[model samples]
Target: MQKIVPNIWFDGTAAEAAEHYARVLPDTSGRVLMRYPEEGLPDFQKALAGQPLTAEIVVGESAEDGGCRIVLINAGPEFAPNESISFMLNFDPSRDPDAAATLEAVWAGLGDGGEVLAELDEYPFSPRYGWIRDRYGVTWQLILTHPDGEPRPFVIPSLLFCGAAQNRAKAAIAAYTSLFDDSGVGMIVDYSTATGAVRADSVMFGDFRLAGQWFTAVDSPEPRDFSFTCGVSLQVNCADQAEIDRCWEALSAVPEAEQCGWCADEFGLSWQIVPEEMGSLMASPEAYGAMLAMKKIVIADFPK
Candidate 1:
C-alpha cells in the first residue's frame, strides 16, 4: 500500500473529477468507497446526503500494487483547490514511443473548460511541458520525460512554496525525511544553479522520498496570493494507533485546524494521519460518530 495518499477535497464533484481523470489519463480508474449516513448527519454535512462520502481514484495502474492513489474527500464548499498543490504527470519517451502524442491527447482532454497556466511547448528543461488547471480548479503539470533520466512514478504530487513559505521547501523536505522510514532527498536544483530567472538560495526544483513514495517541491519564482489548504492534504496511513500518535505529535502545528485526524503542518500544509483500517472502522456508524467527537484518530474509540 502507498504509505502516504493524497487527499483532495471537492465541494461535490469528487466522483465527477475522478471519472474525468479516468477518461483523460491512461491506466486510471475511480471507485466510490464509503458514503455518508442515510440520515442523522451533522449540520455541515447535511447537504451531502447520499453522495459519495469517499472516492478512491487510482491513476496509472493500481494502488494495491504500488501505483499512484488519491482519496477524494466529499465535503462542503468551505475549501477549494489551488495551484499550491499540483500533480506532475510524467510521460517518458523511452517507456512509450507515443509518449509525446499521448501527452498532447491528455493535455487536450484536461483543457476542456480549464485554464492553461503554462503553454505546452519545448523548454530548456523538457522538450514538451505545460501546466494547466482543470475546470475543477485542480492543477496539473505534464511533461515529456527526458529519455536518459532516472525513472519516476507516473504521478507525483508537487508542492509550491509561495507567499510566506518561500525558501522553505528544503527545510520541509528535511523535516519529512526525518519522520518517514525509507526516505531520502532526491535531486535538488537551487535558483543560483538553475537556468531561467535566477535568485540566490531558493529551490527551483527538488524531490524527496517519504516512506518510499516520491514527491516534488519547488519555491515559487514569483509571488502568489495562495498557500496550502485543507483541500489538498497528504494522508498518512498508519499501521496502528502508536504510529498515528507519533505522526500527529510531529506534524500537527495549527491547534485549531485539528479535526477528525486532519491537521496543518508548520508550513500550512494539511495532513490526515489515519489508521490503515480506516475503511473497516468507518463501516460502523458508531465508529463514525465517535470520530466526529475527536480530533486525532484513536483506534480504541472506534468499535467494530
Candidate 2:
C-alpha cells in the first residue's frame, strides 16, 4: 500500500469518476468499488443505502515512475471540490514519446462538461500546458515537462492557499516537510509584487516532498467563496501505533475536527493518520465496528 494517498469525496459520482479515469488515462486501473454497509447507524445507513462508499484507482505506468493511488468516496453533498486543491499531471516527453497526444486526449475527456482554467498552449514554462476543472469539479493541471529538467512524479497533489489562507503556502509546506521523514523543500518561485492581489515573498509556485512523496503548493491572494474542506484529505499510513500517535499530536489542531482517525491541521487541511495494518483489520466486521467508535485509532482494540 502507498504511504500517502489522496482521498476524494463526491456526491454519488465517485464510481463514475473512477471508471472514467481508468478508461481514459494510460496505465490506469480502477479497483472494485465498496459500498456503505447495511449495518451502520440508522441515519447513515438510510442516507447512504447502496451508495458507493469507496473507489480505488491507480494512475501512472508504475510505482517507480511516480505512480499515484487515489481513494474516492461517494459521501453526501456536504462538500464539493474546488480550485483550492488540484492534481498536477506532468507529461514528460522524455519518458513518453507520445506525451503531447496523450495530454490532448486526456484534456478532451476531462474537459467534457468542465470549465477550462488555463487554455492549452505554449507557455514560457512549457510547450503545452492547461488547467481544467473536470465535470466533477475536481481541478487538474497538465503540463508538458521540459525534457532537460529533472523528472517529477507523474501526478502531484497541489494546494492553493487563497482567501484567509493567502500567503501561508510556504509555512504549510515547511510544517509538513518537518513532520514527515525523508522530506524536503524543492523548487520555489516567490511572487515579485506585493501590491493589489499579489503578496510579495509569498509562494507563486513550489514543490515539496513529504516522506518521499511529492506535492505542490501556491499562494493566491485572490478572494474566493471556498476554502479547504473534508471533501479532500491526505492519508498518511503509519508503520506503527507510535508513528500514528506522533503524527496525530503533531498534525492535529482542531479538536472538533477529530473523528475516526481524521484530523485537521492548523492550515485546515485534513489528514488521516492510520496504521498500515488497519486495512487488513477492516476486513473483519468486528474491527470495523470498533473503529467507528473512536477518533484516534487504538490498535489494541482491533482483533489480530
Candidate 3:
C-alpha cells in the first residue's frame, strides 16, 4: 500500500518482466495486480479485435527490508531505448560474499547479446560496480556496496528523467539532488590528470539521495547497445499543469522524444509526466476507458 511503487514500462512484456523480477529478487512474488478483464463478451471481443491485452503486476519482497514493489505495465506499441528513463540497482555486498560474482552471472544470463558498458571493476566509489543490459535490451547497473564481508542489501530501483541532452545520468543526478530535501551525492570521482578521461584515475561511485532514496549515477559517453528504454521508465506524478509543464519542457529537450507521454533525455533515458491524480483516476473500473482517453493525449496538451 506504499504510495510510491516503482513502475516499469514494457514494450509489451509487463507481465513477463514482472515474472522475471519476482524470480530474481530476494523474497518476493509477482502477482497480477490488475488486468482488463472482459467486460462483456461482445465488448471484450471488440476490444480484443485488433488490440493487444494488457496486464500490471506488483513484484517485490513482503519481508521487512523487502518493501520494494514495482508495477510492470505492458505497452500498447513497440518500445525503443532513448534517454528519458533508466533503471538503478542498489546492491548489498554483505548478504553474499560472492555477491559480485553472482551479479555477473545474472548479467551474463540476461545480457547475452547486450553490450557490456563497463567490465566489472573495483570502483573507488564502491568495492565493485559495473553496468550491463540484458538481451532484452534493458539497462542495469550493478553496484557492490561492500566486498570486504559486510552486511548489506542488493537494491535495483528504477529512475525517471524529464529529458537530458547528451547523457543525462550526471545531469539527472545533479537535478535530482537539487530538488529533494536531505539528498545529495555521497562520493564523486572523475578522471584525474593522472588517470585520464579514457578510463580515469577515479570516477563517481557512491550514494546519492533523491526523493529520500539512495540513487547513484556515472557517465557513459558512448551510445551502447544498452541505453535507456521504456522497459523501465520512471513515472512522475505532478501536482498541476504548471508542474507538468515544467517537467515536460525540461524532460523533452532530447532528440529521441516520443508521443504518448514518453521522452528520452540527452542521455537516452525515458520518462512519463503524469498528473498526481492520474493513479486514482485510472484505478477505477473505467481505467481501460481512461487508457483509451490517454492514448489520444498529445505531448503538447498533456497537462499544462
Q: Per-residue lDDT of 43-138 in model 2, one digit per residue for the tens?
A: 754777657779988999564854699998787788787888899999998888999999999999889999999999999989999999998888
Clashes, model 1: 0
lDDT tens digits, residue span 117-168, model 3: 6676887767767777654456677766654643323454534322233234
| Model 3 bad stretches (over 4 Å) | 1-7, 36-66, 81-132, 147-153, 157-169, 193-207, 221-231, 238-268, 275-279, 283-304
Number of the top-ranking candidate, with lDDT as the measure: 1
The TM-score values for the models, in the order shown, are: 0.96, 0.94, 0.64
Candidate 3 lands at a TM-score of 0.64
Q: After superposition, how far is residue 33 of candidate 2 from its true place, in Å?
A: 5.0
Q: What lDDT is reached at residue 226 by model 2?
A: 66
How much lDDT does candidate 3 score?
0.53
Model 2 spans with C-alpha error above 4 angstroms: none
* True lDDT of residue 176, candidate 3: 61
Candidate 1: which pairs clash? none
N/CA/C clash count, model 3? 25
> How close to the true structure is residue 12 of candidate 1, measured as C-alpha lDDT?
88
User: What is the C-alpha local distance difference test score of each model?
Assistant: 0.89, 0.85, 0.53
Model 3 superposed RMSD (Cα) = 6.2
